[model samples]
Target: MSLVLGCNISTFDSTTAPADLFNAVRDQAIAAEEAGFDVVTIGDHLYATPGAPDEPTLEAYTTLAALASCTNSIQLSTMVTSNTFRNPAVLAKMVTSLDVISGSRAVLGIGAGWFEPEHDGYGLEFDAVSERMAKFEEALRIIVPMLRGERPTMDGRWYRVHEAINEPRVRDDLPVMVGGGGERRTFAYAARYADHLNITCLPAQLPDKLRALEERCAEAGRDPRTLEVSFATPMVINEDGEKARQQVEEILVQSGVDASMASEVFFVGTPAEVTEQLRAKVLAHGVHRLMVNLFAAGQDLDVIALTGRTLAPLVSGG
Candidate 1:
């Protein structure tokens, strides 16, 4: 039950190339591995935001493949990949290959997407919210069976598959982590399909979310604690709590999210203070895995390494 420290390599610069992004991720992965992080992750986005379209958007699988070849130990995967981007069967097969390439050190974190503009730009259907969730449910059914080395057919309103087979089963059953916090559908999906679960943007609701997950597990006839719970917090860590808060504020200003709201959601402080907060969060909510998102605000790789060196072992029981 050790804590995992991973980062999302989602850079917003249109001039960036896929190879360039992969190189940056590879360097971060190696640094994290050397610094004793348990995992490294990336996010998937097709179209850039309104003001951020020039953002470098690399395909998740390609970047992961490059990462697998460059790093030896840190388990790597997406923070959560959009379920609508590719056919579930294809995505499952790609993940299986990634697992093999990485010697079974891969996790698949999938999600029902949220960006309507990205969907419209890519010509993927921007279905109603309920329809999207339904598609996600069917996607899981199609993927899990194939990953288990079972060819299964599924017929759903959004996707149809017949005798889908994902060959070269991963070295082990690679862990599947689904992401979201909607209690009714999300927790239920985690109980039914995910080995790991990630949710963000609701630190205050974590305790309630865990309780809901427990209930869902019970209803699904699954052991409640069998699923691993992970949380991702947008964070800024400096030597001083006030300075860290200031840095987070600057990032907020850049992102137009109101600098005054920094302390409300993000964990910003010195390593000691952040560690205390992290421990409190973990103990209170039973979060076994934690990923600190440090995508922007000019964070150097060394800062993340220092985080692993100074903070991870302390909270993860090392």
Candidate 2:
């Protein structure tokens, strides 16, 4: 993967009327695509995360399907779908359907489920971490083969698929993205199976995480260069540099992070300043691909367009 920039629409404005939520999201996706983003993604959660419990959260696949209808070029995916939420075979079919609908622009971004509260609330079994990783590994065994147009039959400890079939796939080469920070299991899985790895960690932690991933790829007898790695972070940017910094500081304080460490957690400032910050803090560490959630942009079209036009160049080698 060449340097890619993705926009993760992780939150919706709480004040928007319930009936108009999808439209609001659609507009944002259009803006992102028009502004040169390579991919547009949303979180796969039954409830809102990284926000209040009562906030409206759309189902990931459904929202991506809706986005595919309106956006022409940008790829559609979940920031990371939880493997615990659906049967692996079914999840593979959903991705294949999205690929067909979007003219072959769907990416399967998945991870071992982590939110216990959602699982508990939905009465889904929240297994131990070891069990979850085991299930995730088994899921890949089933999902990958099906996505490649082969019927997969597997009777594993956590999942069973009997030659499950998938049809109407636009392409068998749809990318598979695994997102997580676990150095042992997650990194190993990404190296072994994933085409892309979105490492979820603070910016400063990336160098060490990249090294660990390299080690994992070596252990798996796979070349690390074959796997694309990316980092995702919250970004706050504006034409007004001081105002953006102030907003970032407030968020840092609310999250109980030191205000002084804002740059390590967020890309904040004017677009030019943010570009420089990203180069120093992210690209310099060998993480060329980046996904950002522009929480501050909200439904503001101008802000979204401005940020995209500014940051897209970083990935395009401008």
Candidate 3:
């Protein structure tokens, strides 16, 4: 795969009225599609996490379904649906439904559930990390086969499925993407079941994560090249490069991210500067796939267009 760029719409402007929220999201998706983005993903959460707890949040699949109606060709998915949020069989069927609705442009991006507050607020069980990974593994066992058109029947500790039949699937070869940074369980799961692995880590940690993923792929007797690797980072771009840098600082402070670690986690500057930073810090390290959340742009159409226009060429040569 070449350098595939995606936009992750993880935040919503709190100022937007409830009735106009979906329209705002739809516009952003359209902007992304027109700007040359290959995919537009939404975060799955009952409530916002990286932002204010009371911020307006949309359910990932529901929003994607709506976007499918308004947008033409851009792929739709969750940044990652929490495995804890839905039953594995049901989630599999949902993605299949999305695929049909989107003209075969749905990708299943999922992860072991995180964000404790959301779980607590919703009365869902938030287990320890190891326990969550255990459940995640079982979920994948059921999910992967179903996506491939198999009727998987497994009685696992956390989930049980009895020849779950998914109907109306647009294609059996729908891509499954696993997002996380754990080299042990996450990478192993990705190697075993996922077509794409979205590694969430700082720039400096990417090399080690990729190496671990390679090792896991080898252990699974799969070619590492078959698994597309991607890195997602918070991005802020402006014509005024200094202003963009200032926005980055403000975001880091607001998010309580340590100032010393800003460069490792953020891509902020003019379009050219951000592109160069991505080239040196991400693409050069062998991760060709990139997903960026435009934290500073919000629902701004022009900024999103500018970003897509500038970054889309990164993959053109390939």
Candidate 4:
């Protein structure tokens, strides 16, 4: 598989309007497509803070509806939808509908819900972590079949659905990607069900995480290679490596990342530098897909455009 670049539109302030966010997504998707990116993805969060503003939380599926209409080639998906927010059968229908509208370009990336504050504010149950995992597993059991055109019926401890048929059945085999890094539970769920497995980028912890995933895949009688392993990192690109690092540092300051450790966590540098680092990580860790989250919201569109025009091609082997 070739390199993939996906930008996650995460707003750090509530000042951005939903319409503006949608327009940025449209423009960015077009730019990414024109720049030769293989996928355009988004993160799912229903919360508001300085780090995540925009009230009423621009629902992911609604944004996806607009995204489906705006872009043709780029695959659209959430980085990971929290399982606790929506009913599984309902969530399945939403994505399958997007698949239908997008001509089968939708992928579902889901996770056990985190962010207890969002749950509490939204009046949703903020279950214990263990219970959340069970709910997540139950969600997969209910969602996968429904999207595959099966009229699913399920009676589980946390959820109950009967003979639910997702209409306008997904136009293709919709990919289900589960996101997390829990050695025992998350990887096991992905090994058993996910088409792609995503984890946060923490280079120090990645080796052990992949090892755990490998073991889980073995226990599930599945080839770990059959599942795509992906990581998300923030990228700062410019002609000069140090200049790019400075740009990333500025963004990190805006995001309130600790001044000392921010640069170490992000991919901040020139295209060649980022590419060299990515190549090393990919080869060393067996990572096949990489999605870089561009924190360019309320920043320079020129930078975003340069990101696609310059970095996308370099990393995509064009």
Candidate 5:
């Protein structure tokens, strides 16, 4: 199969009125659809991170539901939702609702809860990584079956869904993509449960990550190829390669990553060069899909449209 091209609007844009941001995002997604991008994703967060200068962030589901009405072709999804943010049963129902509205164009991209600040700020349970993984495992048990129109009965320690009915499911084959790189637990879960695995790692680390995922699939008695894999990295494409490299540094520094690690982390170059880099660094290692966060390009519609029109054909051979 051809590469699956997905875009994410990361939480890095300037502060703006909520309505204006929503409109801008809607227009961006519409433009992505028109430009032949397969999916449009949003970061799942309660509020903007790095609160020094306010960043305009919205609740993922609400924003996605709104975008579902505004766009026709591009699939709507969370880059990955925090498993602790909502009840899994309710989360499944939410995806079902979106699927009904978007004509079966919704995918559940979820992960173990990570941001401690959001959990503390919102007064939600921010358990340790072990406990969080426990919760994530239990949540998926409920979510997966419920989305397939099954009333799940789970009496787990972390989350309990007592035969909850998931109504209005449009697609029985609704895609469930698990995101993370924990070789032991997360990859095991993905091998067992997920239809897709969105690998969040630096480009250079992809080969090892894919190998680890394959090992986990073997342990789970599943063929690794059964699960689709996608790499999530920042896209920093510019006409001038040096400009792209500089912006990549800025983006990395803003995210608390060392500036020195910027070169191996983002797709920094012109469109053709970026595609060539991805093909060598990521795709050759066996990842066929790329989920790029549109941050270096200011999350603007024009840049996103350009990314789709320019880079997508290189992989799809269109």
Candidate 6:
């Protein structure tokens, strides 16, 4: 089967990011489009995590807006937006606006807010994991209908929207992508509302995640094939095998870890080796789309281009 592949420019903790942040991401988007990636995405976060507090991070939707004007053809999206970051109605309108600006190339990828530090830092609502998941479920109840140009009225426990209107939606089929591999809420939401599910599991765990997703779809009485599955993980590649292994070792060492543990989530190799691992771990497991995070190398555009070029041709749809 043909595959759908996308590159992520998520700067979650990339401290050595480019001095010109916007231009770097924009150039990455342009290069991704040229290299045949289906889409380019960024993480949605106000405060940095794991990395230093002062590390550069661009707000997700704003960056997408900028990328929309500067590039053409590539779909623009947040790999997964936090549901609590904006009010449900406001979130729906924001994505619709993005679709309008990008000429129908927007995918609203959202998740239950997990980073409590970011919530505390921004003074936004921070609930327990269960509560956040519940609110996220309700948010989808509002967002899905609103994106379809409907006037939805929901008296949700965490949110209430009455006859909310989102107009000027470019297409009736604009896709909503659900991120995270939660067996409970995220899976249910993907079965009910999302067109895609970006599984946040390590490559080795993908097969199990796919089965859980299918189970969720069955419980929802929805067709499982309707929801596309994408594996989300860090992809680090280099032309030299030794250099690639060194990069992996450096990351592991700096983080005070060992190579064996890091290898589960990080893919570091020459293009050919990367392709082999992806094929064996992801594609062989029946997942067809890959949302690879390649920003750990800072704003090195050549790395992005090489990674994209090597894999895109093999994964592109007809």
Task: Return the candidate ranking by TM-score, descending.
Answer: 3, 2, 5, 6, 1, 4
lDDT of 2 by residue, 24-62 (tens): 999999999998889989889987765556789899999
User: Across residues 1-318, which tens digit of lDDT does each residue of candidate 4 receive?
Assistant: 222566565543245575576675677667766665667766677874325443535577788778888887888888778899898988998899888889888889899978887788779998999999999999999998887788878889988999997888645468888888788999999999888888774666778888888899999999987888777766777767777777667767766877577546776677677777766655466664667676653144555666666556544442
lDDT of 1: 0.76
* Candidate number of the best TM-score: 3
Each prediction's TM-score versus the true structure: 0.92, 0.95, 0.97, 0.89, 0.95, 0.93
Worst 10 residues of 5 by lDDT: 47-56
As for TM-score, the candidate ahead, 3 or 6, is 3
Cα lDDT listed for each candidate? 0.76, 0.87, 0.88, 0.74, 0.82, 0.82
- Order candidates by lDDT, high to low: 3, 2, 5, 6, 1, 4
Cα-based RMSD of the predictions, in order?
Answer: 2.3, 1.7, 1.3, 2.7, 1.9, 2.4
Superposition error at 139 for model 2 (Å): 0.7
Q: What is the lDDT of residue 54 in candidate 2?
A: 76
Clashes of 4: 0
* Higher-ranked by lDDT: 1 or 3: 3
Winner of 3 and 4 under lDDT: 3
lDDT of 3: 0.88
What C-alpha lDDT, on a 0 to 100 scale, does residue 129 get in candidate 1? 80
Per model, state how many residue pairs clash. 1, 0, 0, 0, 0, 0
Candidate 1 vs 2: which has more lDDT:
2
RMSD of 6: 2.4
